[model samples]
Target: MTSIFYLHGGPGMSVAVERTRYPQAQEVHWWQQPPATSCAPHPYLDLLEAALVEFRRSVKERGAPMTVMASSFGAHLATHLAQHAPESVERVVLLAPTYNPEQSALRLARRALALHAGHADADKVTAALAAYDAAPGRARFWEVFGALQLLPDVPALYFGPQAGDAPRHFVEVLQQPGGFDGVSAVAISDDFAATFRTPGRSAFNGPVSVLFGRHDPMIDAEHDGPIWRAIFPQASLRMVDSGHFPLLETSLEACLA
Candidate 1:
């Protein structure tokens, strides 16, 4: 059987494994990039690609080739992996992938602000954003992140059973001292952002599957959907009714389908 790998977002974190498991691929393995610091200067591209290449090698005789479901930042890495090692990847599934950084950040920031409009602690988010504007550092970014969490952006209509517990996931990660800082450290590097800003190679012309939430604050569906379709002609786009985190927002059946 072909092995399926699920790559989570947050650069520093992994997807909620328990929530993403579905009947289509009941036992999909999860992959996370190495510490940005560990692979200093190179980001996690080489390491991730090497691992996936190994995965593809393992199941060569299997009925299917290895498939990757990469989310957000992982999507960027997955795209690069396929570009570099086309033979190693069977098909790429971009789940809320961050194909464009500048646009995605604007969309996410706007969603957080809208969710907190006129609500309690709204001032806090405003204050945090203001702080980020002034200092513009990782410390301030986390402050903004904590502030945004106060808003209930994940709608109950589409958010699955794990909706309520979503915030805790990031909170726990933040509580760990210097844990994810490396991710932020490398992420904000001028060199790193530029790589994604201008993908050196042409669009990935390969078998691909793209899924983005209709309510996703991180992806610009109107703009990105067409871009993705143009890049991967064989890709089938599925617009889900969820936010940035689909596993927490959509049902397994909906996700696997």
Candidate 2:
């Protein structure tokens, strides 16, 4: 039986949805390493290394090909792994990948990084956001730094009906000690640009697939879709009728298909 690994999005989220969604697969593995709140330099790299180690172990146990289903931030790590270790990964499914960080929405996140580096008070920022959340007449404070600090409220903004549970779980993880460290934030910002602009030459000779939602706010489908198609000429391009979290909608089945 082939080994299938599911990598969840965000630096803080767990693999609960991946497990529940793809329960029938044999030897399903979820990548869970250092919590997102940890102050690691490169959380993605850390998680990627951990996931690779687990991938190796699973490969040995199952003694077959491997497939990866990665979403959001996890997709970035999965693509990196696929490019560097093609021998282990046969197919890759990327759901709502933020391949390009230069998007307008990401500007707020970049600003948040600047704020953190400039010694901004974390408590003050969090309190202000909490106040905004409580107020009905206030404008939505959707700044990236604020979002990073208060990730628990992100689901409410994006997922609406599905936001409450996932956002709470995300907040719990984000609030953990050492979570959202400076180094990791910087690395994510840099890597996001590098992934799409110059995906460094690697011997990752394998089939690649990119899936995005039609209404994805993080990525500009009109611009990014063509870029990805051009980069991976043999790759498949898919647009689903949903928002950024296509996996949370019906398009995921098409992705797996």
Candidate 3:
């Protein structure tokens, strides 16, 4: 098995859920975004790149190129890493990656807002969005909105398929103090939304495996799947019978298939 850097999802959650739940027997370093350290600050692209530099160096010293396994927002960072440092990435497994920044941001806003619509918290959501719109800087808005998606999405996509204690886990983490630092990572990339370079065959020739969930509304496979397929010549995408979190709902072997 190749050495893997497991990056967790979230415009919210910091813990790399896949690190523990994946059950993959590989040498892995769980890399958290917006690291607890002070070196990582706003304009998170620089912060993340620095961390990747260290990861790249560590992997090279050991032997092979690093295989990056990232989900949700983490997948966006992986895409950037592959583009900026093609040589450092040996193989990549993108699990329901929100590759397109503009489209992803819009979709996240719509879906997350819809999650609260016609419900008791609909007014709260409306007010929050309105407040964010009024703010001069919306970075903190993303931090809060990022975590909002997990509330409804995770129960079915993650906990339902894998863990019996998902409800408790989700609640406990939401209640945790200072767990939202990683949400800024999503906001940090907003300014560069227009500049995301889609990887072409010439850019990266690595074997890329994309695992998607056909039923994921947050990331529609029909709309985004072709974009990814066209980007990487050797990239193969397998659609699982799950939601956004396919690995959580389906077997790891199934995702690889």
Write the candidate numbers in order of decreasing TM-score.
3, 1, 2
**Least well predicted 10-residue stretch by lDDT in candidate 1:** 153-162
RMSD of 1: 4.9
Q: Which regions of candidate 3 fall more than 4 Å away from where they truly are?
A: 22-26, 36-42, 101-117, 123-171, 182-189, 192-202, 251-254
Q: How do the predictions measure up, each by TM-score?
A: 0.69, 0.64, 0.71
lDDT, candidate 2, equals 0.58
lDDT of 3 by residue, 1-257 (tens): 66777667764465535555654645767766554334444455565676577667767786777887777767766776777777888888888877764445545565666755666555655665666667624454654465455445434433334335544555565456755565364545553452445566436778899887666656777788787877666788887666666656665556545
lDDT of 1: 0.61
User: Distance from true position, residue 220, model 1, in Å?
Assistant: 1.7
Superior candidate under lDDT, 1 versus 2: 1
TM-score of 2: 0.64
Question: Candidate 2 on 68-97: residue-level lDDT in tens?
Answer: 878777766776677666788877777777
Candidate 3, residue 41: the lDDT equals 42
**Per-residue error at 4 for model 2, in Å?**
1.9
Tens-place lDDT per residue, model 1, 1-257, is 54666666756553444333343555566554455545356554444555556556544745455676677767666766666667666778877777765446545655667756888888888888888888775566667766776777433322334456655554454456643554544454333454444454434455687888776667777778777766566778888766666764565445556
